[model samples]
Target: MTKPTSETPAEDGAALLDDVERFHRRFNVFPHEAAYVAVALWDAHAHLLDCFDSTPRIAFLSPEPGSGKSRALEVVETLVPRPMLAVNARAAALFRSVSDPAGRPTILYDEIDTVFGPKAGDNEELRGFLNAGHRRSGVTYRCIGDGGNQTVQEFPSYSAVAVAGLGSLPDTILTRSVIIRMRRRARNEKVEPFRARVHEQQGNALRERLATWAKSVQDRVAGAWPEMPDGVTDRPADVWEPLLAVADAIGGDWPQRAREACVTLVKAAQVNDKGSLGIRLLTDLRDHVMVGIDRLPTVAILDRLNALDDAPWADLNGRPLDARRLSRMLGEYVTADGQPIASRNIKTAGSVLKGFYTEDLWDAWARYCPPPSASPLLPLPDGADTD
Candidate 1:
C-alpha cells in the first residue's frame, strides 16, 4: 500500500476516495462500513500532508474468527502509502519505521486482540506508544549512540494505523479508533475471492492514483476544516475530522455518506461501551424521563424503577433497589472531567437532591443509549408489571 508522494488537483482526492471504495467493495461489507474503510485508506497517505490533531485508527473487530477482518486489512494494505503488514511486529521496529520522514509506513496491525489481550500490560510501552501516537507531534524519545555520543533523539510516532482482530481493543486504543465491527458473511453475501495476484494489481494501481491525488491536494487538505455533523464533539470530533475533510474535498455523495457514517458509527461506539448498563436503565426509565415532569426525587424514581416486574433491579442481590446502589450503577456515565452525564441534582420533593433532569437524560439517551422502544423493557403486558 506504499507509494511515493506526488501532487494532484483537489477534486482528485474525491476520485481517489472513490477508487478506494471500489477496492473496498471487492469484499462484502456493510455500505457505511465500506465507506469508513475507504476514508482510512485516503488517510494513510494524508500523514505527509496537513492533518488534524489526531490520526484516527481504523479498528476492524469481529465477535468470532473468519469474519473478513484480516481480509479488509489486506485490501487496505494495497492502497495505503508505505503499507506495512505487521501482524507480529516488534515494538522497536514499529517506532523506527514511523519516525522516517522520507516515508512513513501505514501500519496495518493484525491480531491486535492478542497484542492487547490478557498479557497486553506486559508490553505497556508499545501500548502507550499506540495511544500517544494518535495525535499530531506525538513522539517517543530514545537515547542513541555510546556514552560519549549518547543523545536523546525524538522519534515521530504519529502515523495512520489499522488494527484488525476479534472482539474489542483496550479502552484507550478503542476510543482513538474508527471501529468497524465485522461479522461472518451471511450465506447470501458474496464477494470475489481475494486472490493475491489479481487484488494486488488492482490495489497497486489505486495506490498510485491515491499518491498522486494526495500530492495535488495536500496543502488544501492540511488547512481544510470540514464541518462535522451535530452530536459529534471532543475526541470523536478530532478523530473524524480528517475523514470528513477528505469527504468534503472529494465532494458529492461522499460528503453525505461520510457524515452519515460519522454519526452512525460514533454513536454505535458510544452505545457499545461501559454505558450498556446505563442504557438499559435509561430504556426502562423512558416513561418517567420523557413525561412532562422535569425532575423526580430519588425515592420516586427508585419506586418506578423497582416496580417493573421483569427488571433485575427489584431483586438485586436478593434485595430491592436502593438509593446507594442505583447511584453506583448509573454513575458510569460521568464525563471525562468527572462531571455526571444524563443525571444531576434538581429541586424536587421540596429538596435539592440527586435526580435526572429531562434535558440531561434525553441528551444521554440520544447520544450514548440505544432505541428505548426496540423491545419492551417488561416482557409482560403493560398492566402486568403491577408487581
Candidate 2:
C-alpha cells in the first residue's frame, strides 16, 4: 500500500480516493465509469456515515445469476467499517445486530432477491427494517421477553447497507438506494481474480487509510450541502447527497466525476424504472401519446396507449388498457389544488364522450413527470410519429 504523502487533508483525501477507485477497478468490471466512481465514493462514505443524517443503501443488482453481483458485495465488505455480510438472515437477528452497543455495522446483504422475490412470501418485517434504516433516527419497535413479560422496545435500524441480488427491489427500498446494474464480464473485460486469502489484506489496508481520511474530513462532510446536477432532485437528490459530499471533501476531478455519475445513473434509473405503473402511464400520456392535443377522448387515449409496442398498457393483466382502468389509474393522481384528476364528459364534434381535459392533467404532469427534455429516456412508443 502506498502512503499518502501530501501535507493537506484535501490532497491526501483525493489521493486516497483515487487509490480506492483503482483498487476496485483492478477487481470489478463495472458497467460504466460512473459505477466505479459511485462504488468508491460509497465505500468512503461508509467510514463517515455518522456525519450524514441519512445513509443511502448501495445496491448491486442484476437480471440473472453469475452477473458478479455477489462479487461486488464481497469487494465492498472489505472496505467498509465493521462489515456484517448477511445472507438468509432473519429480521430479528439483523435488527438486533444493528442496535448492538458496540456500534452500527455496515450491512452487506447478499441474495436479497430471495427476501423480496416471487418465491419470497411476505417478508414485511425485513422490508420494514430496510426502509426504516435509511434515516438517522429510523428505528423498529419490537416486543421482547417471554409470554406476558414481553415489552415493546425501540431498536435503532439506521446503518450503511449494501445489497446484491438477482433482480430489483421494492420501490420503497429502491428509491433510497444507489443502484448499480451489474452485468457478466465479457471475454475481453479481464479482472484480477478476487480470492479472500490474497486480496482481503490489501483491501483492509485501504479500509484503514479510508478511515483515517474520513476522520480528517468528518466535520466538513457533516456540514456539506453539495450542489446537485440539473434534473437530479427529490429522492434522487437524497440518494446522491452523501456520495457527492464525499467527493467534494476529496476535492479533485472527483467533484466533476461525481456529478457526472449522478446525472448518468439517475437518468438510467428513471429510464429503466419498473415501479409505479401509474407514473409510467402519466409520463407516456404527457410525452408521447398526448403531444399537441388539448383533449383526448377515452377511446382515443386507449388506442394510443395500447398501440405502443414497448409499453405495458397493451398487455396489462393479460388485457389491453380499457376505459375503466385508465380512469382508475389516472384517478390515483391529484391536481395542485388536491383534487383527483378524473375523467369528465367531453363534447367532441356534437357528440358527448368520457375523456380527459389537458387542463386537469397539467398539474399532475408537472408534479409527477420529469420535464419533456428528459422524456427521451423512454423511447417514443413503437412506430408512432412524433412530428
Candidate 3:
C-alpha cells in the first residue's frame, strides 16, 4: 500500500477520520478536545512499528471524578494497537513489556493521578520510565544474575502511551504530552452509554481499519513534516508533529481540524502547566482590565494582583511585589525571541507614565494563557496589534 495522493480523494482516510469523530462524540468532551484525542489515537496506532522521533502521550485530565476519563481510556483500549489496560502496572513489568522483541503494545494507563500525585516518591522509577519513553531512542538498563557475574541488559523503552486521571500529571510527563482536559457532561448534553458487547464490536471494527490505513501510510508518515501554526514551538511542536502528519495524510476536514485542535489544546496546556511566574502574572492580570481605560499602570496592576486573597504576589520574598520587581519579572514578555507579547509604554491621563495596555494583556491571555472559566474572550477588534 502507498500513501494517499490528491487524485485518490482519500475516501479511506476520510472514512477513518469520520469514525474517529464518531468515536469522540460517544463521550462528553469539550469542542475540539475530542478531535485532538482522536487524532492522537490515530498517531499512536500508527506510531508503533514505525520510527517517529517523538511518540506523544495522550494525557486525559479532569478536576473531579465521574468525568468520563476512564471511559475514554476504555474506548481507547478497544481502538489502539495491542492495547494493554495497565492501570496498576509495575515499573519493571512495563519496561520489560516494551523490551519484548515481538513489538510494543499501546499502554493504556487509567487512574494515573495516583501514580504521580503527592505520594509520587513511591513510584519514582515508573515516573522515570514515563518521562524517558517519549522519544524514539528511549532505553533503560537492567542487571541480571549474581553480583560478580551480573550483565547489563538493554531495554527499548519507546512505545505509545495514553494516561487518564484526575488533576494534573507531573511536569515531566505533562511537557511530553498532548494534555486533554476532560469535563463532566452538562445537564443538557448527553451521549450513548458504552456497552461492552455492542461498543466493543464497533470499536474493534474501527481498530482493524485504522491498523490497515496506518500500515498503508507508514512510510509517508515516517517522512512527513506537517506545518505548525503560530504560537506552537519547541516541545509542543515536537509532540504534535506526528498527529498533524497523520491528519495531513488523512486528507480531509481532518487536516484543518487537527491544526485547530493543536493550537487550542497546546495553548491551554502551556497556560495551565508550562510557564514562568511572569507568564502566570499575565494570565492573572486578565481579571483586572477595565473597560474604558484599556490600560493599567505598573503600580495599579501590582496592587490588584497583591490584593487577591488567593494569590501569592503580596509576599514575594517577604514584601509586596512592587513596580520594579514586576517589570523585571515581565521583561521577557516585552521582547521574547524578538517577538513582543506585552509592553510597558506611556499612557497619558493628564500625566504621562509607563503602563501596560489592557489590549496587550487580552492578546497575551488569548495566545498564552489557559481558557477562561466562563467563556472564551472575544477576539480583539481590528487593528489592535500588540506585537
- Name every residue pair that clashes in candidate 3: none
Instruction: Summing lDDT over every window of 10 consecutive residues in candidate 3, give the lowest-scoring window.
Output: 40-49
Cα deviation of 365 in candidate 2 (Å)? 1.8
* Candidate 1: tens digits of C-alpha lDDT, residues 1-387: 233443422335555676677667876474356445445544544544345667888888888898888888888887777888897787789999987768888889999877776556456777878987888778888899998999999888888888988777777788888888788888888888889888888888877776666665567778888898999998889878888777776666787888888888888888776544566787666643335555676778888888877667788668987888777766666643356654467775567777765544554454666555454332232233345
Reference-based TM-score, model 2: 0.85
**lDDT preference between candidates 2 and 3, better one:** 2
Q: Write the per-residue lDDT of candidate 2 for residues 125-224, one digit (tens) a residue.
A: 9999999999989999998899999999999999999999988898899999989999999998999899999899999998999987887789889999
List the pairs of residues colliding in candidate 1.
Answer: 1-80, 2-82, 6-215, 7-215, 7-216, 8-216, 14-250
Clash count of each predicted structure:
7, 0, 0
- What TM-score fits each model? 0.69, 0.85, 0.70
Residue 132 shift from truth in candidate 2, angstroms: 1.4
Q: Please identify which of the two predictions, 1 or 3, would achieve the higher lDDT against the true structure.
A: 3
What ranking emerges by TM-score with the best candidate at the front?
2, 3, 1
For each candidate, the alpha-carbon lDDT, in order, equals 0.72, 0.88, 0.73
lDDT of 1: 0.72
